[model samples]
Target: MFHTDCPAREVVDHVTSRWGVWVLISLRSNDLRFYELRESIRGISEKMLAQTLRALVQDGLVWRQVEPTTPPQVTYGLTEFGREVGESLAELFDRITQRLSPRDAG
Candidate 1:
């Protein structure tokens, strides 16, 4: 029988990607529209945001919802799986921050 490789590698790559992590962390706050995410994540180029969102969506970490109303409203939010991933990353960030306080930064 044919079997596939572990999906962890891909998931890690997607979630840990430079923009991917920020996007996930930002979305952790609440569902955000495309422009809202762009604005919230300052200095993130439009191209990078688009690409990151696409990759996250492919990894099933981000849920993109589109409404057919005029002007077409699209919002992005963390899926249940993504929330778990985001929480883990958030904890890692907190630990790293605590480890690297002003004393360590100096």
Candidate 2:
């Protein structure tokens, strides 16, 4: 459905989905482990977070690295392309949040 014709719409949908926006903005600063991301993003269910990460990975916007270890450490970070997109999303997130604040609304 997304890839039918408008590639821009597909990218916008991926970047702006509820959890997708938060995920991209969260990863803008540093690489984070699965639990770290879960903790950082309040109110996100485990299933939803997993699904969001999977979609971002499929979109080439996030990188999933699995290290060799006893339990196997997994971390996520943005790709170069993702970083560029993430920065834009971050700015948008900030602007929206600020504009919607009580003081700003008043």
Candidate 3:
């Protein structure tokens, strides 16, 4: 799967990117508005968040909904496929955290 043009590689890159993983994990539990998502993922700049969301949406891993209103309320959430991927990522993240804790490391 290491071939330069492998499609899985692109998917993996998107899912495992520095911000992508965090985004997926954050959206796994609930859909969030742009600002809500940005706030939840601390330290992520507005630009980065937008870019990440765009990629996820294009990949069919996320759904972007625009509510009709004066200001156009926009929300982001994981697709069914995204939920599955996010679930696995969440489990992996938890395991990593557990293993790295001082109590576990000792």
Q: What stretches of model 3 exceed 4 Å from their correct place?
A: 102-106
**Number of the top TM-score candidate:** 3
Report, for every candidate in turn, its global Cα lDDT versus the true structure: 0.89, 0.90, 0.94
Model 1 residue runs over 4 Å out of place are 1-5, 102-106
Which candidate comes out best when scored by lDDT?
3
Worst 10 residues of 3 by lDDT: 97-106
Q: What is candidate 1's lDDT per residue for 1-106, written digit by digit as tens? A: 1234667777787888888888988998899999999999889999999999998998889999999999999999999999999988888877887889788754
Candidate 3 achieves a global lDDT of 0.94
Per-residue lDDT, model 1, residue 44, is 98
**RMSD each, Å:** 3.5, 2.9, 2.4
Q: Tens digit of lDDT per residue, candidate 2, span 1-106?
A: 5666977777677888889989998999999999999999999999999999998998899999999998988999999989999999888767887879688754
Model 2: CA > 4 A from native: 1-3, 102-106
Clashes of 1: 0
**TM-score per candidate:** 0.83, 0.84, 0.91
Model 3 alpha-carbon miss at residue 18, Å: 0.8
